[model samples]
Target: MARIRANGVELEYETMGNPGDPAVLLIMGFAFQMTRWPEAFRRSLAEAGFHVIWFDNRDIGLSAEMGGLATYTLNDLAADAAGLLDALGIARAHIVGMSMGGMIAQLIALDHPRKVDKLVAMMTSSGAPNLPPPTQEALAALTAMPMQRTPEAIADIAVKAQHAIGSAPNLRNSAEVIRQNAIDDFRRSDRPFGVIRQFTAIQAQPRWHERLGSITRPTLVLHGADDPLVRPAAGEDIARRIPGARFKAFPGWGHDLADAMSETLANEITAFLKA
Candidate 1:
């Protein structure tokens, strides 16, 4: 709920746990707000003996929007996160990112090696052209636009998208909770153009898949075996390319960070960082 100027833009961020503890900076993906990171998930990391930080990336949530520009690169987004760390006086921290956030985390580690102690890339791809693309249903979910900007309209599209790419039916949040979260997100910010801009940036970024080997930080790649958006092989490819990186896949998991997976992901990430 606080704002700081970073990378030439104002970013909205929140911190949990003591500043004195080891820091864990979380970067969410695509058009997602930091709130999509899940409170319980962040609390679990905080309670597990680390300071947890989550923030809205530029042009999303309460953060400054850049609609004036036609497009920006992921490196720009990555620098925004790195600058946030500098603004906060955090010298080094465990960096974690999901989906597109994971790609940004890779850039941070590559571009600002001294600022990252450990790296966790979850449910993300390396932009490998040969890798399998998203399943038709998942692609539709990601590219679907709201018919109208009304809260109900936005929430409906969100619900459908979540259902399309989320974990198995039993592992995801209840339908009511999903709908409510969609509504809450719409109320927070209804800028569909911001999402299109982000997607454009992702597509426009130069391919950096070959640079993974240069990332010497201890790295972990986490993915859901059931993920139809970014298949499990994508995560595996990242692990394979990064010299000493570890890969872990969950059987019932998927592209979405459902409530059922939070505790498990917290434990897995905590153990890796602690190691």
Candidate 2:
């Protein structure tokens, strides 16, 4: 584990495999830490012969949270990615992101094309700012009040969070793990409002539909057929907008990529890179 001053904020990052291998940077979704990428899964990617780097975004994990209300734009976040690459002495690397991370990836591909070797955008959207905004139910879940984890509340919170975000069909863990992780991660920092504001900023960005054509790199778009948070429609629209982008979605999958489909995700991503 290490902290690197990036794009103005200190970012926490961890790596797997040798630096001599091809580099693969994995960015997590909104308000999530890099731990969302499981060790075993990261190992698989590393074993596939790529150096894998996973890191915490601004307000998550051990990274510096320059106060939740300071505000940040997608351009700012993209610059952070670029700064990270610069700090690591990497000119370019395979970039993969989930959900909001995908949004950042899109911006990076558009603004810093020279810094990315390939792009894999999973479970994300263009956020045309106006078109098909997240379902009210989805928004509600994202903005819902956080419930403290008590012996009695664990099951309920787990169910609600799972219901709102769970799309994994092949998950091996029970409800306990989900509850524990959620509670722990949510409390890692003191600012849930920061997440909300970032979501709002994303919502307020100019529609990304128009510029998807400019992203010419080999790109892979993955979505869960069962994703409830950002519907699969977003993925479809993205694939259509980008030139020669391959799209895939799995059934019984939801917003959280950590669950059942991670293996398939790793497989598809690795295969696409090789192809």
Candidate 3:
């Protein structure tokens, strides 16, 4: 792990594979740390001959926090991503983002086109008003306040949320694995307020469908067919708006990226970047 000054904040980041290799920058979703990009998944990408970069976005993980701030937007987040690349001396990289990260990735390709070689927007929407909203259960799980901040309590809530929006019954992880991940994540950082701030940023972001057309980079849109959080229609709409962009959907997948889906996700991502 290392720290770099980006977008007026210190960002925590890690890199895998040889620096000489092509770079793949992985951005996580709302309130999620870079660690959410699974180790095994990162390894697979590295083995595929790419340098994988993972980092904690501002206000999350060991990165700087925005205390007492009222609001921020996705453009600010996009700038941060660009700033990180600048700090690391990477001229350009394949930008891969999940959920909110996808929104930021879209903005990066629009705002900093030269810095993004290829784009992968996964399990996210274009933030258009016409896009379908998340299901009640998924929304509730996302917005529900935790009863306690204890590791176990947070873990329980996390597990419940995962079940509410994760892969179909047969493709989900064992309870033990989910519990462990929750505990680990909680221990790393439990700042619910920061998460709320990130949520605020997402809410404040403008719809990107109008701007997406300007993204001329090779683009790939990935989503779960049954994702309750960000519906499949959102993914389709994104692909439809971006010229020459390809869309891929997993039949039974959901908002959560469990171990069961890692191989398929990594393989598809590798092929897209290579092509």
Looking at model 1, residue 76 earns an lDDT score of 95
Candidate 1 residue runs with Cα over 4 Å from true position: none
> How far in Å is the alpha carbon of 47 misplaced in model 1?
0.8
Candidate 1 lDDT over residue span 42-142, tens digit each: 99999989999999998889998897566799999999999999999999999999999999999999999999999999999987889989999999999
Residue-level lDDT of model 2, residues 122-186, one tens digit each, is 99997665445566666676666647535345445555666667765365345676767666665
List the RMSD of every prediction in angstroms: 0.8, 2.3, 0.9
Per-residue lDDT tens digits for candidate 3, residues 1-275, read 99999878799999999999999999889988888887778999999999999899888998888887657898999999999999999999999999999999999999999999999999999888988899999999888777778888887888889899888977777678888888998898877888989998988887778888878999999999999999999998889999999998999999987888888999999999999
The Cα error of candidate 3 at residue 89, in Å, is 0.2
Every model's TM-score: 0.98, 0.91, 0.98
> After superposing candidate 2, which stretches have Cα over 4 Å from the reference?
129-133, 147-158, 168-173
**Residue 106 alpha-carbon offset, candidate 3, angstroms:** 0.4
